[model samples]
Target: MTVFIMVADVFTGAHVWQETAPRLAAAGSEVHAVQLTGVDAGRPATSASIDLETHIADVIAAIDTVDTASDREIVLVGHGYGIHPVLGAADRRPQRIARVVYLDCGMPQNGVPALATVPDQALRAQLAEWAQRGECEGELVPPARDEWQRWGSTAGISDAALDRLTALAAPQPLGTLLQPLRLTGSVVVVPTTGMLCTRNGVSIDLVQRLVDLGDPMLTALADSQVTFFELPTGHWPMLSCPAGLADALLRAAAGEGRSLRPVGAGVPPAHLRPFPLDVPELPRDRREHVDLYVPDAEGPRPAVVFVHGGPVPAGTRPTPRNWPTLVGYARLAAAEGMVGVTLDHRLHDIADYERAAVDVAAAVELARADPRVDADRVALWFFSGGGLLTADWLTKPPAWLRCLAASYPILAPLPGWGLTGSRFRPARAVAHAGALPVVLLRAGRETPEIAATVEAFVTTAKDCGAHLELVDVPNGHHGFETLDPPEEIRPALHHAMRSVVTHLTS
Candidate 1:
């Protein structure tokens, strides 16, 4: 016999699983939608003392209720804050949990609270500040129906379902989120399934990319027991498409979803690849975050400040400034009668682009302040994800800013990034880049997700009549600078360099 337990929190309950649970039962499984302590619908009075431990105990009790003699396969499906109790229960009863499902959630770490795992970074900081200030002591009231997207995407949810959600949603007990999660090492090896909500900013492909990055912490994601699935709907799949969510859940239980493997067969990691250029390495003025590659035959010369892409691992050694490709670009710029600048920005997570932008701005200021750099003539070159940083300079091109360039860039924010009202959207801001020479070195063979963003920005730039020069590397990949042969990409590299130099010098 197979037993499935459902868990969710904050303005929702087992009731949210109302539509999906029956479908699971019909498909030959016993389903239990475990209502947690303080927010249990059966109890009208919410005890302030009810915390995460209360709900964790509730799930364990639900698991224990299943007959032991029947020999059951227990699958715990956790959504949002519900994952806390599910994980807690799984930790205590690792032997009983057949599989664990992570449904549209920011993966919570052992020592962190649910609040720390929130997808919205700004909101997370705001909530933490509010809690520390003692503004929301007892519980956090549910967001209004329209504000639901602040927590997660609401793309596929219908009006009636949203109304129901608002009506049934309960105040999330603040204490439940305040306590740090404690876990035993036993739960680390549990078989896991991840159901990604593509509209919520994660997909199987994105997860695969992260796993491919070879981060030891994320390597388990590529384990054979861990599989993945993508739902086209938004965060609330149970409310949006119960039938589909039910079907996926059933498939997940059967291990019918996509399996991922780490990138180690033949292809070298993108960053570890050798720099494509054979330019003479120049001595760099290694300041803290910003590094300057001064030209040998230079007075005060034009500077091309290279901003490397990331939300790279914060602990990544030989930081961006020291990366061969970045160093190569700086040297190449220095060889072309210009100052080459590279900087380390804090883009260690998807939510950190804002802070990263600040770092970029400060780095640029630092570069311009140098006596070796001609502050009146400067170009900004961005790579990969750092391409989004072009928005600010494009929107309000300074007199000293000669040109802005991006190679294989993500100009707009992905949907799931939840970067609403953000200024880092070059696709939209390019319209304001009047007379600002914008050079884009696009990779023809870029990843589909990133390619789509590039295409959007290109279309917008053309329509808005922005001064744009597009150079296409038809056979190049995302990090083609190192991935492709030196001979193939060298011309394109030199062409882009000359273009930026012309904008700076001409």
Candidate 2:
């Protein structure tokens, strides 16, 4: 196996990988360090015109130069700013890459530039100031060595190495930071691993916090088939904990600690049988497949269509074909003697709500048409962001839809993804709803914005004469059912699931 290590930059990469690459090579792996354009000591400084695409080209060229035959499996590793170019290169040459590793750096999402993806708002402001100053002088922004020292790890590196690193540092191209990443969502096919540095006390919990806060980069990473490994070191793990980082990367490449069974495995005994519902119209790459969990009984059974949340921003790909929470609900539906149908719908930006709605409708039609499902007694289960797409169906629900179950749904347009004159407003939809029952599951510790949306939906639905039942989980958060809440909250979780099952069964 071959490991292509993309150094964070001319200086940091030189210092960080000095110890790490040799360790990987000693383990019988070939190592190649990527050198970006205009990053060497003798090379001329890059201009504002030198951008992310240029660095991406450099990475691809390096890969080509090192792997002439392209027969060996290549592991793509990136650190700091290097992650951006490496991601771009992976997008370009996904077939050649086996695994992608992110080392103590934020992941990048399509359409988000390196500068915009910086997690620290204060740092973003400082960089903006630097860019402004550079613009005034008609020169590219110079590298901030002091800022790098403040943020980077100096723990394991000797004093001599630190001095050498400082001396070798070169000014980074401002355009690379300013340029937004472009991806076709295909890069997600390559498995990704995160080597997180915990010296700053950053843990998987912190990553989850970022996901909860809707950090686009973290959210995208979480949605992918990514595993995290914690290293008790500083931000530059390659320099601070090279040996440990090397071991973690090797383990990740070998798929250690991952489930041996295929994805969407571990369905409980309750789900009598599970099978995929094939839709020929959708391309295989789109992953628009559904799984049907039918009860053991022979005759037609009452059914509930489970729709997962996340109209995940456009250009982002969801890794797992089926979410475990939704699958659990499917099993619960089966346990309650009803057929459970979990479908994958197209997740698009708010602007493409209509297209996604069509996917939902297609899923419903498929469920109703199945001989195993009782067409006249079907129900719809909407979770999280998928709740927003239920407006039309809720407003003028069909005769066959018995009820609707919404858990921590986003009823209104989320902050940044709002659309003008859109018909996908839950508050307005409930005003025109038919005589159908709706069960609303509210999480107590949900973010304020989501809480407000739930509250408004409940209030407006009641005022509009919509029949609604509220199930309160006092100790739960937004993803309580899936988050593996404490034992105390288990009863509430079961109760909520039961409420939905009972409503659909009734």
Candidate 3:
């Protein structure tokens, strides 16, 4: 087996893998620490012009140089910002790569830049300021020795190793951080492992929660056979805890790590059971399936149709069996004495708003026709992009619909949807909603564009005298309901859920 290690920003492969590579090699595995083009010479010159593509090329070339026969099993290990290039290389040659290991770094996502992946808003702003000042010619220079010192001993790097790393550190190209990643969706099938650093007090459970919450990068990894291990050291575990990092990587490569638990497992409790709904109207090409979580109560209960959001690519389908959040919500609805229905809809790219509306209508009809559901008391629940398809219902809701609820929904027409030929302003629909009750669950830190659209809808609904109720989750972000909510905001999530259920059942 050959283990290819990718170094973090500003540091050479030798500096990053000095201790870890030897341990792996001693254990009878081949080790190759790939050096980026500019950093391979020990330091990047000020005049160097490097970007993400250059680093990706460097990784591919290293793989080619090491795996001449291409018969050996290879594990791609990337630290820090190295994950981006490693992902690009893996997407290019997924057949050759067995597993990708993210070592205390952010996971890579399609079309997301390295700079955008930085979680800290203040730091991103500072970097933007530096870029504007032409610092390092619009590149991000390595942090000074003093700056590294201020990072403190938390990373657990030895003084000698720290000195070597700082001495060898060089400027990284801004283009690498700014450029968006391009992927062909092949990398999603490859096995992934996260060697998380716990110095920031993030646990493996917290990471799993983030994945469950639909954090895009974590979700991508989790969708595959992903595993996680926590390193008690700082972000630079290769430098701080090389022996342990090496062992964890070896175990992950050998398939010794525990697989993530399948979502929506086990029985739905004594009060609820899964009921399959037949939606013959769904396109034959799409996943034609729907599940109804019917309460074990009396007949003719109020029901709610759960529409999972998408444009989930062409190949993948979102289902309650694969997403526990959907099942969880359905269970919650059942617990509240309502028949909960979840259904599969075509991707936004493949199906127009009209087509999705038809699917929703079919699901609603299925619920209405069910012996256990109250046809006149049904409600519609939309999440994320699925909200875009509800324009017609908002404009002229059916007589049987009790209310409409949307969480972190898309209310405007965006690119990639064939919306140029259609008129699909959700605000316009809201303005003509009449007296139909509408509940909107909003995340406080939602993107500016979404916030603006939500604001417009609220204002329009108010002006039109529509029965609109806004539930603002001050501490929440988008997908908070499905994603693990922080302790403080759990109550808010529950309150929002209760509010929606009340609106439907009242």
RMSD (CA, Å), each prediction: 3.4, 12.9, 12.6
Q: lDDT (0-100) at residue 84 of candidate 1?
A: 87
lDDT of 3 by residue, 277-296 (tens): 21122111112456778777
User: Where in model 1 is the C-alpha error above 4 Å?
Assistant: 38-40, 133-136, 158-167, 208-216, 240-244, 256-267, 275-285, 295-298, 442-465, 472-495
Stretches > 4 Å off in candidate 2: 9-11, 42-48, 66-70, 126-149, 153-158, 208-224, 257-506
lDDT of the candidates, in the order given: 0.84, 0.67, 0.68
Pairs in clash, predicted candidate 3 = 213-483
TM-score of each: 0.86, 0.48, 0.51
lDDT of 1 by residue, 1-506 (tens): 67999998566877999999999999899999997776867644455566677778889999999887787799999998888889999999998888999998767788777778766667677777765775544777888888887778787899999999999889877767766678877787789999988777677766765665667777778888989998987889999999999999888888788988666857665676778887786898987789999987748999999999977877666677888889999999988989999999999887888899899999999999999889999999999889888998989999999999888898888655657778889889999999999999999888655787888998989999999999888899878887787787888988998999999999
Question: How well is each residue in 108-175 modelled by candidate 2, as lDDT tens digits?
Answer: 87987776544334455555675556532222333354444444444555666556666767666666
Per-residue error for 177 in candidate 3, Å, reads: 1.3
Pairs that clash in candidate 2? none
lDDT of 2 at 254: 76
